[model samples]
Target: MDELKLGLDLGAVAEALAAGEITERQAKNASKFINQVKAVHEKPLKARLIQSDRGQFLGEAHPLDCGAWKAYRYGPEFRDGGKVFPSLEDAEQFIING
Candidate 1:
């Protein structure tokens, strides 16, 4: 059998959960999988980035950023073409428009 790897973004997964498309257990499973992967890679297990008041960079596409957005329950707007939106309201509008 071929071993195929799959990748999942926690923000996207949380969005699914918030939208009622996925269950809380599913989100937890995803998080567990991510933690296991990090352990294998010898990486720290954190789920949020502290963007300083000046908006400092926390590495390219850090996982904490994902967790922060997920915690904000901003997944629905994010998936509906609002990924680049500067505000959550704007993201919702984008979702309504598109």
Candidate 2:
């Protein structure tokens, strides 16, 4: 996996903690901070949309089928799943624009 460019200097913080320069509490706090930073950078670069309940849109995690994209909503409602788009472009366009 390629390294994501997170602004948090996790290496220096870990090094300082290991060298006894920072307390265990400081290290723990730093770990928590780094996790937040990691989450921001770890988000998908593209083609990943957030799932919303009361929204009128489709997510980007759809599957390709017969040159068309099929979207499935996993919930108690919608027994047969969601709608289908004619192409991947249609899926992404609807995902972002809608």
lDDT of each: 0.45, 0.58
Q: Candidate 1 regions off by >4 Å?
A: 1-5, 43-98
Tens-digit lDDT track for model 1 on 1-98? 00111353556666767888767877787767766776767866443333334665221112333332222223354343213444444433433434
**Residue 50, candidate 1: C-alpha displacement in angstroms:** 44
Q: For candidate 1, what's the RMSD?
A: 16.4
- Please give the clash total of every predicted structure, in order: 1, 0
> Which candidate gets the maximum TM-score versus the true structure?
2
TM-score of candidate 1 on Cα atoms, chains taken together? 0.34
Compared with the true structure, the alpha-carbon lDDT of candidate 1 equals 0.45
Candidate 1 clashing pairs, residues 3+ apart or interchain: 48-64
